[model samples]
Target: MNQVEHVANLARLQLSREELERLSTQLSRILAYMEELNAVDTAGIPGTTSVVAGDANVLREDEVQPSLSQDQALRNAPDAVDGLFQVPQIISDR
Candidate 1:
């Protein structure tokens, strides 16, 4: 099997022969580009974390706010018991 077929199997994907061939060529080109990037020299350059210029915090302050009561919150629930929303059991005891 080719590299694309192996990768598809690992990802649990069922690709056709044509798709495998196409992906193989695309993956080869991507890897070749990565190799070319790896060959660049950056001895005196500083590493960059963000491409944006500003380092300011852009978030609002966290403050206490009034929220809905139990009845108001559970008013739109399809299933509610006591004061909480109830969901169907997903796990078995077995």
Candidate 2:
């Protein structure tokens, strides 16, 4: 089996002869472009982990605040009993 066939099998794909030929050419071109990129000189250039380039995390101070109680929270629930939200039973005995 060829590289295309091998890759198709590994990916659980069923490709026609025309599709296999087309994809093989496309993959070959992609690999060639990667090889060309690898030949470029990147000396002295710092590697970038992200495009944004900064610490993303910014947190606010945690403080006590007035919020909804259990009754208020469960007011919109389709099913609620006492102060708890109820959901349909999903498990069944075999």
Best by lDDT: 2
Q: For residues 1-94, what per-residue lDDT tens digits would candidate 2 score against the true structure?
A: 3999999999999999999999989999898888987778999989877778584876788988889988889999999997898898789777
TM-scores of all candidate predictions against the true structure: 0.41, 0.40
Lowest summed-lDDT stretch of 10 residues in model 1?
52-61
lDDT of 1: 0.87
- lDDT (10s digit) by residue, model 1, range 1-94: 4878888999999999989888888888898888986778988988887777885668877987899988999999999999888998889879
Q: Positional deviation of 38 in candidate 1, in angstroms?
A: 2.6
lDDT of 1 at 39: 75
